[model samples]
Target: MRDFMDYVLTAFHHKTGWNVDNSYASLTTTANNLLDFNVPHGLSLHVSSLSSPNFATSYTLGSKGVVDGSLSFLYTSLGLNVTSRSSHIPLANLVRGYRHLQHLSLPKGKALNDVQDGGTSIAGDGRKDTLLYGRLYLPSSSLEALYLRRLSPNRLLRLNCVSDATLPSGGTVLALLQNDFGKYTTEYLYSTDSSLLGFRALYNFGYDPRYPLDQQHVSSRPARHPWDHQNGRLSAGAEAYFSPINKSGGISTGLRFTTLPIHTGFPYTMTLTLNPLMGNLSSSYAVKAGPNLSLCSRFDFNVYSYESDVSLGLELWQLSRPRVPEEVAWVKDLIRPGWEPKVAPEKVVPDEDVTGVLKARMTDKGKVGVVWECRLKELLVTLGAGLDLKKRDSVVGKFGLEVAYSS
Candidate 1:
């Protein structure tokens, strides 16, 4: 049954070219990634096996001689991660937001869009694509698990579980069901933590593939408008959540304008979100003005309190020219007349070329952060620092160095 569903979903995706970012919650993902810099606070080291992409270990030496270590394994569709001395680590580090793909790396030569095409296995790879995958995280004091399955081209189900000795209820579970209707998307969420129920919906003002065939008025389908090909797509959405136990509810609405992967022009994204109940309004704009530079800015305001702040972020890269002069042609072949561009063969980037990146962000409140990441001879190194201009003393609040090696 799962195999059949996966096949159907892949077929539908191929026909429509619907993208994962159409979901309501993903509207600001691009901007957030650029602006949300983690402030590293301790020495960290990570080692992995080059022979296998699935196994790795990490150690962090924090303040007061507190040290933490973890081991992780990934086999086919199953993932297991265990940590020791987690209680000794700072609670803030453990409770920070989690990114599902933080550790994911794309196979050589595979463009992000290619891998996102309905979860099909890469050609010639003997391993069959797994329709269901799960991850289990075990720490000294708590447990966490995530399971996800694809029900159809337009439907998905996810289950999340967390258990800890400190929790009053011992554990919490959350279930989420997402539906992609060609022109719109909807998601339903339930959480045991607060007896919360939520519903969210996103509707695209532009073209979308998830719309069912019966709903598309074939006879009245209009010819492509000039703007359809020249401008980006627009979408609007809202979410509402209620807690029966607390007898409380809240709602927020947002709008997004983003260029599709096929735009073949300067890429950009803009988003605006508002929470009327809290009188909070936020917006962001991110743009890739050039090949090696990108900029993002965000503004937040509270109507009730008359408070406002702005922040800016940027990413600068150092790239070397491709070694083979012929390979440079591929850059010009960005778009084919009517087909998706094929992933080019993996090229060996010159060791000295395409080396380093610098990402930094600053807020109006005088909080600033910067991170410089680069690839060394056989290791990847990252250096980061955080500062507060308002502080008379302790101007440099935190800083850290991280290094990773694979052998």
Candidate 2:
């Protein structure tokens, strides 16, 4: 039971660990291809592939690069990007500072990677950054503090404080304070009767001030109304228990309300657990302004709306090997005696089939579409169509076909 409703199931008895493969490397190449088109203003794309894979490690390296618009005078951009992993640490000799009693991110693998990467990161006028973070935790005193500094990319500092206290009445209270040398955010949480009931509050002092003032809370104090012009924005909710702990399911409800401009809603959610079948449902009231964001079932809609991107995803595992076509078998037999093609049965991506639409989006309005894709060996075929839902005009319908080759 993790917060944010993120639950993962793992088999402790599996013979092999989870596979993390070259999918990320392939994605990096695809992203680089996309960057080659529609150049951003004051930016130029390099012809060479910047997202090259790092073969140095047992696995592929994670690569990222940036184009400096400020250095327009040079024909080429400054080298300000790096590809590294946690275990690849460098520059251990340059660290300075001492606090043995506190938690320190002093030397170790992280320091090594930062040192090696920092020197090569000369892309923009922004100086490279070397981080030094430390923390002191005292459980007996129920107190904690943290400090972090950036030696490069301009001097930057952050501070953190926390405290947790347990009352004789079997209750616990928590407080946290964090500041990044600019604004500060504070949070307080209280649990009564051993977490049967809980409450939390947050105040953000350094929020953006450009938003229109909340006329409803204009008279409220700064503590209650942290954002300018915004009235008191408070949220409260409750949890009810059902079934046995860890062996059953439960339900919970919450709400967030603001005084002025009239914004209020009840957040409803539930967890369904039944043997091998499990899922969670949730609702939010935030409006989505871009296609990249998922549409909220309740808030992302109005009287008139355009939802161009509808998607259906399908994946197949435990595939049955397809028999070679008769014609292909005949050709293979003619080439040699008992000739057969090779296959990597252990590869997650089976060789039986492949093909896809490559890419699609809701680039048009008032249209509904269906797409079908199949994979055959290293080739993928995709066929799809879109029809105007508002009208059945056959001539206005659209159909598309795409084929992809991969190895």
Candidate 3:
């Protein structure tokens, strides 16, 4: 068993450039054997440079033990043009077959608009800022045939701060702001011997302030304008899943409603996915009718399979929207009262309707296996071609190589 597993893993690694980023010297061979002990732990670190001055480094660590269940951590840093830097971190914990908690931290530099101007005209400032966000989740699981189970409510908390300074003649002035946002979400999930249903509700609240732009022109100039806007949103949704009937595939449908109290009307969305042939084919359709109208459909078909080792498939998607009165109202709202929305005046009418369509097709040729592996190793390689067509526009072609791997 050990030799067979090793061969499979080695083949997968070679084909997919496994561990291609990190310096392998930092990892020990024992890392491969840890999985067999029923203790799955893995770490991947990598660094790459773009051109001579831009680079990025990423680290991912995860472990799954019988007692602790699962825990994972990730960190990433990106640097470009010696002037910009950004970093983010995310962590997750799963216990008792449920996702229990997650945390995310993202810190970014000032807007890079200043870099475009040739000289440091006090505009292309790249200052660093830090932010942290976190969430906790609870899930329900059935213990035995006699007892029922229920999941606890979930909670999320987020905090972020921005500290940036401008280089001005007056002196260094600290421009700093902090804000806290939080939400509580509860979900009821139900499943019988063969079907599933779920409903969820969420409440959210948050606030943040915007700062005035700094003026660098020495002479007398109007003080930078300070504008602030605060807002909140509330949402709820329900979903149902049905098992396949006979040889036909399953079905799932969902609806979501959202409201922005300050805004006029509530917005809602509906989605549905159906598999007619329990075989290797599926179709999905969705329509969003609210402030805007959008229609979308997609079809997927699996063409061939080889000993569960390789597979080939094709997919197509179509999206379309019709011009309507709401769109005209939206455009008018953007312009001064007397000034009409810019267009061929003859073509600019309140009731005029426009139609737009977008279509895409993707085909997967074939895949070769055993490219590389160390733990749970799999490697798949294939060639894919795509075409994107838009109404009243030139069609675009896309060609690329597809490599897939998993452990």
What lDDT would each prediction earn against the true structure?
A: 0.59, 0.25, 0.23
Q: Across residues 293-392, which tens digit of lDDT does each residue of candidate 2 receive?
A: 1112221112233222222211122224444432343345547966643311111122233222122222134544444444444333345555566675
Provide the global lDDT of candidate 2 against the true structure.
0.25
Backbone N/Cα/C clashes per model: 3, 17, 12
Candidate 3's displacement at residue 324, Å, is 45
* Cα lDDT of model 3 by residue, 364-384, tens digit: 322111111111112222232
The better candidate by lDDT, 1 or 3, is: 1
Clashes of 1: 3
Tens-digit lDDT track of model 1 for 1-407:
01112222333233333345658888778777678867666787755441322233332233414665444332323122222122222211221111111101112212112232333534432222222222333344465555555444456676877777788799899999987764688999999978999999988764444342334453354335322232457889999999999899999999988765445455678889999999999999888765456789999999999999999988765665635533346556765466434333322233345566677899999999988776666666678899899996899988988765544
Cα misplacement distance, residue 319 of candidate 1 (Å): 2.0
CA error at residue 183 for candidate 2, angstroms: 18
Candidate 1: minimum summed lDDT over ten consecutive residues — where? Answer: 96-105
RMSD vs true structure, all candidates: 9.9, 25.7, 27.7
